[model samples]
Target: MQGIELTLQDEAATIELGEDLALALKAGDCLALSGDLGAGKSTLARAFLRAMADDEALEVPSPTFTLVQTYDLRIPVSHFDLYRLADVSELDELGFDEALSDGICLVEWPENALAALPKSRLTATFSHLGDGRTVTIAGEAAALSRIERSLAIRAFLRERGYGHAKRRHLSGDASARAYERILVAGEPVRILMDSARHTPGPILQDGKYYQQLAHLAEDVIPFVAIDSDIRTKGFCAPEIYESDLDAGILLIEDLGSDGILDADGRPIAERYLESVRVLAHLHAQPVTRDISLGTITHHIPDFDRRAMKIETSLLLDWYLPWKRGEKASDTERTGYFAVWDQLIDLMASSEKKLLLRDFHSPNIIWRGERSGFERIGIIDFQDSMIGPTAYDVASITQDARVTIEPDLRDIMLSLYCAERNALGAFDETLFRRDWHLMSAQRNCKLVGIWVRLMQRDGKPFYMKHMPRTFSYLEVALQHEALAPLRDWCIKAGIL
Candidate 1:
């Protein structure tokens, strides 16, 4: 799992390797570089730093004289040149420990401090190979595994005629999936999805993994199936150009960068209304459960009582303890479940449609130039299921990332209801009830998720949305059906 060898034909190839490494390594990582003075160690380090900064023209002077240079970029980096006969004790004065604690470290002439470098550090050794250079990368199994997968993606893209395409990081979600935009010489932009198969966590219940119990997609089959199915039904899902199901990689159409939010991250009313209209058009008809591809059929999972309860219980399992600094008592826990069980029973009888579990602003793309449903580009529907239509409505109205003002939220809801009413057989009263119910349900899950993200996942940025979520929960709690849960939350000091 160690010692990956690559041959770089010229300076460009070496720079590309450094760019690829930037995507693989993270904070608290150290890459030890070793080579002769004229070798490509310093070149590779410079390229790596520039890539990390996302600036090819970023001035990165050699640290040979100063001995160390640090840049506080996205994932802060420290460049150290240790060829000055420096004693190992000099590292203590150079703040080596603090540097590694805060961000990544790249050491040239690591041989000078062989006893001081971390054993888990990745090592990249360069040597002259014919007219170019040969680089050997060795690292701990976990780090090497990341690099291996990244190289596999390069191979996949190369086989698909995008070998020379420039890769730029777009985003990474809460899941393991990462996305990159591909820029070719004279072709339309494309997207590369690196959804490596991630089977996370131990068996949490019923001898199944947590993802299995929650009906989350472990690989890319569900995404491919759902994307194909939705596109066929006139939705504007991205077109898939290439796929490696075994490797969990995809080269798909780029759906542009226009979203329903503005530069300040506020929701645009016109775009939000269009998104609602698109959903109304969709939920008016029954969705096919089993989607067929050329050789494989994917059956969409059901948002059954078990899955819903598992989600709702997160509020009890994480949020309550996190807020109150202790676990809920047995009696309080029993009362909470009793209320959710009743709510789920009521939702079980509502109209069912394909529910995009996360239909928020982050997953939506605004195609203003296109008309009708084509104006909305949908992504991140892999966890979609056959569930109550009101759920998706709630997801957008009370978006997790953006705040939808009260008047705009009402207008969006009215647009959806009016559209469905014109389509016939739509009970506005029943839909409103389910809307409130689902909103409360969704907000509960989000409150717990924000806390869980901070407490368990070491991501505290999501916690900034907690107050907004709590405010949304207050709106949902005004409903009479959620009175029991609302009272419980009030007593629990969360309402």
Candidate 2:
């Protein structure tokens, strides 16, 4: 009863619904199909399977004869035809439990095995409607909620004339945002940015939520504003073709897949240098903090001491407890903040710029054929802030995700300094010092982030990067201004 009802006006609509479900369903999900023999259940199942395979021509035979058919897929699927099932005990022999444990299950004639189905399984009951079919998908709240969002996105795209475009799921980053590539015949591919407004977490410190204290974007407005502003400045931020700001949906240009990393995932020297040049070009000019969004004005936040200190504290709060199997002591915490306090004070008068908070490989799209600064496509700047120029420089040079060797790191830094020098009075010494300070600060935050992602978010894939992050931190601490921090790290055992 806790679900949504949809009308499939034609076969195409039925297939679309199946595709939508493919996007919403995950491992351990069971989609129980209920309908008369000719009421389109098999049609829906075939569409779901083909979409999951990302191959339109994928063979999807009915499971009625075999009783069950399984396909090894991105998320493996098991199709079950339970009409021949005589009793609940037979479900066990059919590997029902194994199917549910490993991947998604699409069970036809679910009524025959009602007693054996998962209590949380989604049931799509289809019935003939005039010349079409009507389905009411009912399920537990969690699965139904994801389906609702998918339906909402479909409606949004329909309203914007992209209803018929094929949707291919793209891997999302650490945020709750989702992305899909839109494929339409004879049209340039566009990306659908499905970023619902962020839900605030419980207050963590100083009567503010973690997102509030950290200066993270709470909605898509910042992204839209930054995208518009950056394009005006001749940068390669995606062009928004259509947007529903209230719904947090946008149809934007698809910056192609080429990146600064090579096929082997290592950083390419030339591409990395071009990315460094992007930051140089961006930092050399002054830009306004106020961005206009037609009816609204979005002001970029300053990367204040509060935000910076809170970030560095993540190393204490998450990483230390994870590594040492205990919380950091009060003295250890005090000493860590003492070093950061001095570093922040030293950069109080430093020149500020529009820092693309994540100016690294993952966010940079290499536009090999494009001319000028447009050669680099910059995505993921929603968290943009007015911060010290060295922050962005540090983000790319000592990229947390990529291992930049000392020689190449120095070359990239030198290139950035040379570019800035050509533009105006640039003191390499002060910039390099700030770079080291910012690098250490960012790596400290990342070291904690990797652990937090594993422990709090159940994403252990990030933990593998811990060694590289620690190495980057060690490199940054060699700076003389960071001597106090280095000594503290040694005492705390993180160094």
Candidate 3:
């Protein structure tokens, strides 16, 4: 898509452009504004700040003398005028890295410090066009595309000479795919897209297998199944109007704003209990049929035991370094494997139930209504299998990153056990022992996964959660059932 082009004829137009840009600004965004003196750079910056901060009268003076001005908005905003800098060394002294790490930055005369600035920074060049000016914006192709869309939408409104207001929204690959599939399938669906990136893959389909997967998904997921048969007596997921599973495409119902995760993005207290209930409901139904896992893992390009071991070795490789601030020795590595072997054995002995292997925070949505806990919506169940219940429970309570409050965790565990007892399949003591064992195992695997995310996938965001995952493992090791494993971790120096 082409980048957005805007012609500013008056102060109102400039402010309108600022508002448009504000909608697209995210944390850590850098905007380089280049223009001659009196090009209304400060005026445009003021408008952008006002749109974000909601304070129209906020002062935004030129940083001619100071070189940089900072503003505390919904997120941090930095205004820099490199026009006055004597050398790039001045920027280094001013803590430029600290500012960019936390907020959006606006730099005027960025060329003066070009060598020292980030390569990915956005550039907005302003030039005098008759009484006003022409603004040319360039940045990452995706960001530029958004700037273009905003300009188009703004121009559409301006032609009508009426002010427009609406809640700001951002679209990701998943959302774009959802929209594309709906268009192709001729189905109406409501989808709310967010900026979070959980899994890695394309979000839409352009081929036959993807279309077939979408059709199969529509058949299996409960939401669509319920719509097909009104007599079906269960809360399924909302009908997926369209999907392209191969492409990660989906056009689904808006499950509303009440997700199982709290407002601060933490998993809600009852989530653990609700997840177990869902698993019980699924497993209660006799499996009088068969199912396939998927082609991703099935079609092994080249499966070798050594290769698999190398891939799994990433747990000790990356996680141990980040956690211990050093790499594991030969003896320590052997101990790690021994612990994993024991945990796997424990998992094998547990009673098997249908397992959503990744039944963790991101996969669940909170419905908030409180009718038999049907409020919880499940996603990412394509990896579901017939496995032990402890696996799913471990995925929820001792999540790799998000820490569930102890009080809530205890309450939810009690609720799940009680529900199983009411259903005549209760084994509280065994469940407790298995729960700790599984939690320790899962966290161990997560430490590896998180490390892989950073070093292999080139995503460092997961690294920040390493300490929490280590802490979970530490607590799990302290349990009486996990005493041996705890000692092993200590011997390996992972404790």
Candidate 4:
């Protein structure tokens, strides 16, 4: 994870490094500048600080005499010049711990108080190399690993003829994957997807890890495969420019910023209608389980009983315990899975289609210039699988994040059924039945996921979506097929 000797050819190169580092940096990260006065440490520090601030003209006077300078920027930053400190004991008076805890810290002359500095911080030692500068980075394993990944991303871009592309940070998902916009001078903007190889967790089922059991794609192969197939089918999947499958890096075409949501962050009727139509069209098509990719074919996993059971078990494992403050015993766990197993099997009434996994607003890119279903640009489909078509319909319409109102949700269901039945030989009644079951299952899984995100990932932001998710679960469980599960929840006082 650690990188060594990265030579900066000029001031611009130094600035570029800072920009790239800015994408990798988070709050509570510390950058220890251990370099000679003329080695451009302050210049590099200022470059990073300015980039994070998104204000290149923001005056960043050297923290030489001021000792520490705080910025009211994105993810608050504290720049410290420890050169004049009499002893490490002065760190407490300067609020050093508080600065490190709250923001990204850039410490100049960190060698002066080396013993006081945390070992987890990245230390960049800069030295003169003719007119340029050479920076040798060293840090604790985790810090070094992150820096190494960022540097590898730099190399990935360079190899793809985007050596001078300006990297801009983009929003990340709940998953570990990271993304950035790579803007080249005279070329179309592209996305830099950092889908690092998933480090497998402990075994969960039949000697398989949780991701494996859940059919989650560990590398970028599924994404590349699914994207290629999606584009071939005339949808707007981002075109891949470069891919290092082993390294888990992809440079793909940017699909612009038109989302299915409006400026108010609410779902637009036409856009959402088109989204349902897009799903209907996809479900109607003859989709093969295997996706052709050059000489290698990617086989989309089945939404089998094991995966479904494991997913639903998340409710028992995380949400139920969190909500009730008491874990389910062996009898309850077995009974819970048995109920979902029967409910999920009811979804087999309709022919299976490739479940886009996350067919919701957040992942849907709206392209106004395109016509009909093609206007709905799909992303975040590496976890696609052969499953009941109703699953995706339930997913988007009964979205856990967005509250699509009851009337609108009804309209969406009708629109989807109209499109699917228009093709003839479609069973409207069966689809709705399966849709209800899928909605319940999906919402149940989501409640658990939200709780797990809060307790395990330290991401309590998803907790706000729980009430909506729980409400959807109630609507889904209203179906007679989900009575046992509903009764169990009521008995457990979770309903």
The clash count for each model shown is: 0, 0, 4, 2
Candidate lDDT values, in order: 0.89, 0.90, 0.62, 0.86
Candidate 3 lDDT for residue 130: 93
- Taking the tens digit of each residue's C-alpha lDDT, what string does model 1 give over 1-495? 378999999888888888788878888899999988777888888888887887779999988888899999878899999999459989888998899998999999999999999999999999888778999999999899888888888888889888877777778988789998887878998999999887678877888876887788999999999898789888999999999998999999998899999999999999999999999988886789999877888999998877887787789889999889999999988988888899989886698889889998999999989888989999999999998899999999999898889999999999999999999888888889999888988888888888888888888999999999989989998989889889999887886
Residues 398-451 of candidate 3 have per-residue lDDT tens digits of 665587777777776777677777777657787777778767766776788777
Q: Report how far off residue 351 is in candidate 4 (Å).
A: 2.2
What is residue 18's positional error in candidate 1, in angstroms? 1.0
Model 2: per-residue Cα lDDT over 1-495, one tens digit each: 597888999889999999888888989999999999889899999989988898999999878878999999989899999888778898899888998997999999999889889988999999999899999999999899899998888898898888988887876788888888888999999999989999889998889998989899988999999998888888889999999899898899999999999999899999999999888988877777898888899999999999999999889999999889999999888888988999899998777889989999999999999888889999999999998889899888888788889899989999999999999977878888889888898999998899889988878999888999989888889989899999998988876
Give the top-scoring candidate (TM-score).
Answer: 2
Full candidate order by TM-score, most accurate first? 2, 4, 1, 3
State candidate 4's TM-score. 0.96
C-alpha RMSD of each candidate structure in angstroms: 1.8, 1.4, 8.9, 1.7
Clashing residue pairs in candidate 1 (N, C-alpha, C atoms within 3 angstroms): none
- Candidate 3 global Cα RMSD: 8.9
Per residue, candidate 4 scores C-alpha lDDT tens digits across 174-236 of 899988988776778789899999999999879999899889999999999999878877777
Indicate the TM-score of model 1: 0.96
lDDT of 1 at 490: 88
- How many times do residue backbones clash in model 2? 0
lDDT score, residue 225, model 3?
27
